[model samples]
Target: MDFQLSEQHEMLRKAIREFAEKEIAPLVEKMEETGEFPLEIRQKMGAVGLCGLVTSPEYGGNGMGFLARAIGIEEVSRVCAGLGIALQVHHMCCWPLETWGTEEQKKKYLPRLASGETFGVCSITEPSGGSDPMGMQTEARLEGDYWIVNGRKCFATNSHVSDIMIIVAKTGTDPKGRPAFSAFIVEPDFEGFSLGREEKKMGFKGASSGELVFNDCKVPKENLLGKEGEGLKIALATVNRVGRPGMASIGVGICYASLEEASKFAKERVLGGKPIANLQAIQFMLADMFALAEAARILNYRANWMMDQGMNCDTEMTLAKYVATENAFQCARLACEIHGGYSCISEYAVQRFLRDAWVAIPSGGTSQIAKIVLGRHVTKNF
Candidate 1:
């Protein structure tokens, strides 16, 4: 019932906002222009403890929890949606390692991931598609001292940049003849592993999305992430727990930025010898945007709070993800409409925000998929 952010959360939000405005705002234009990931900013993000918000302190992370992670992603996304998503997916990769890794695995990899010395990724979607994880064609077989993996995963964020990745592959058949999947930790330099071409996308200009190819990729037996045949659990739990909420935060950020941009432009833009802010139509548009953005934020924060409380929040996370992403797209569209002809011009950031808003739609899962998740929950509980 309480809606207020704690003093610590408030302070974290402010610090992240200031960091984005100072450190990242200046680079936004260049990133959009170049369509390249800013590798230089990785260490700076690490230095500020932004890389490991949900990771435990024992492994050199801040151990701030998921709410802090949402706040950080929101503030950064308010300035740059691409960067926000990059950081979010980065956390997506780290979640399995931190949550499911063994004690030795944690010590060996968590420190580097926490410090931003190495980037991490999790690849589940393969060339066939992402909708069915079990249907993925990637297969791994046990050898003498290693697992030889062969498959191709597509639409992976940070595919070109990540040093380590959690790879999901079919290990064998279940007792019922269903595919048995397992998760493994694979290094990019491993034999038969290669980075594939990057996909040119509609938005998220500065974030990298590409394919990963594995041809007899060798992974040590020690690198198995969890018990054999548990890949589906790891992937599903991660998407529900981390991935959906992360994308929702990005949507909230896009909506927030749209509101700000539309408001500023309306106030400064003159019409009938007065500001457009004085017009009833402009006022109505802004009001709608404000409501949507506020609602998205509340839903996002609520889901994250439930997560921090160790509750079953899969339904909440999906609802937030569905609503936030849909509303973000609507808000961005309105902001562009409010700008009129200027929205079509590349010179204005509204156009870019609009493009980025579209990308958020399918980042975690499509809105229809989210609805299916919520529908199942409703059918079961209601």
Candidate 2:
């Protein structure tokens, strides 16, 4: 198997990394201080085709597929994981609209989404719980030409800033009396729909994560994303196929950041009249960090490659997400240790890396959920 990245991929990586260092790095301090998502920066990323990587060429996208998407996210994340995850979740909204949207819907929304004319979100979580879809309290009822939706969604990414949001709401009951759900596209002009409290997260400070409130919201029937009762299927596919891989990419980026910072500090910092790089303990710690970073890269890249090839890789992607995110947290801690007292300071990037690493753990799916998926897959097939 080939281990090296293609020329094109390498070029894309370098370009994104350079862009992050030059363009995004300058804004990190301000963004973190205020906890704001940089809409202008997102638009710039769209101008460069980063926002439209997986979108079709017919809609002005580059059609670069998941590997390119992962690479872009990873490179950006290496400099600033908040922006990396924000970009990743931004693609989450685009994925479903492209894969499941009707021609009319795609025509109307994909172009704008691709151009970053407005941001998008897939709102699924509720106060009830996200992992358990059946427990969701959000419900919608069919009216004349519109559906009246009433619910509250919390911990939704881009809730306050998104212009286009696809929301999942219970529409009916199944044969067993379980709630049947459907997905709908909610526009900014939708009546009775408004942004709720914006959550101040511990990490990813610049990336918006908050609540969406829909009270007697009027949504036209045409806004239904797929066939009725298909919301669960679409939500599952989108989260597994698109969200998890993007999250894995974020983890890989954080891993890279950890190793890079640790290595740089070890080489430069002097201790006992010599550089810390000469110490066996420091060397072993750096070696471990390096290994974890490499492993994260391999797992995340391979999972994204499988997605690009149109292979069924949910389990593979789950494993990648679980391992990469967990290792990223661990690696960030190690990097902080290598940095000594300075790592705890907000001025150092290592502290930020550690914060971002913790946030990634449960973003796509919890590491516990990932293991359950793997366990089920092994038991069912083996």
Candidate 3:
């Protein structure tokens, strides 16, 4: 198989790299310190079409393929992961709408989302449910022409800023008397819809992460995202197909950034009257980092290709998210060690990279969850 990037891909990568370095890198320190959302920078990403890489042109997107979307995430993440995650969640939230929504639903929401006129968020995780979304307690009872939603969603990214939310809620009763879930498009202005306090996170300080509360929130029947009882299937499929790749690409970008920074420092820092680049220890560390980054890039691209080809890539996507995120954390930690005392300081960016690296492991799926998935794939044990 060909490994080289096409001319279009090359141009896209270069353009994103230039924008990220010039626009996002300079604000890293201040954004972290002030805990600001960088709305202006996000608006810039929208104007440049980064917000809708995989969306269709009819909906104000570029109608590009999945590889292009992966590339965009990688490039932006290399400079600022918090901003990368913000964009990634936005795109992930749009996928369900694009894939399952009726043409009318698409026409109504996709354009504004693609144009960045309306920011979006996904609400699946609840105060009681994190890894096991099947245990989610959010309920939306049908009442004539509308649905009254009553539940809470925690750890919701962009919850405070989003104009629209894709909420997963129980809509019917199953054979065992358990609630059957459904997906709904909830507007922020809907009465009884409110946001909880913003979370103070260990990283991704520039992005908003908060809780969403629904207290008898009323939504029109037209807002139902898909057929009732299909919410779990839709949520899992969307998460596996699009969310995993987006998150894996972010890890790849962080690995690349860590390696780049460490290499630059190694070339300049002299020890024993010679540059650290001349030492075998530094060379080995850099080599390991490069190998991991290359593997991650390949894994990410392959999963994205499978998606474009209409192939089931559950195993490969999980592997990509697992290995890439763990490798990124390792690379960041090593880079910090290589930087010595400066790594501990907030000004150098190494510390920030270290903190950001931890987010990848849990964002898509925990390492334990990935291993369980791999086991199921290999042994058919589940």
- Rank by lDDT, descending? 1, 2, 3
lDDT for model 3, please.
Answer: 0.85
lDDT of 2 by residue, 1-382 (tens): 8878889889899888888898899989987899998878878888877889989989867888898998999988888888888788878889898988999998898888888777789878898888888888899999999999999999888777788899899999888887899999999689989889999989988988998899999999999999889998888888898888888999999998999999999999999999999999999999998899889889888988989888989988998899899989999999999999999889889999999999999998789889999999999999
What are the per-model C-alpha RMSD values against the true structure? Answer: 0.9, 1.1, 1.5
Looking at model 2, residue 282 earns an lDDT score of 94
Which has the better lDDT: candidate 2, or candidate 3? 2
- For residue 253, what is the lDDT in candidate 3? 91
1-382, model 1: which lDDT tens digit per residue? 7888999999999999999999989888888888888887777777788888978999988989899999999999999988888888888878899888999888988888888886678779987888778789999999999999998999888888788788799999989999999999988889999999898887988888899999999999999998999998999988898999999999999999999999999999998899999999999999999999999999999999999999999989999999998999999999999999999999888898889989999878889889899889889989
Model 1 scores worst on lDDT over the 10 consecutive residues at: 114-123
TM-score of each: 0.98, 0.98, 0.97
The 0-to-1 C-alpha lDDT of every candidate, in the order given, reads 0.89, 0.89, 0.85
Give the C-alpha lDDT of model 2: 0.89
RMSD of 3: 1.5
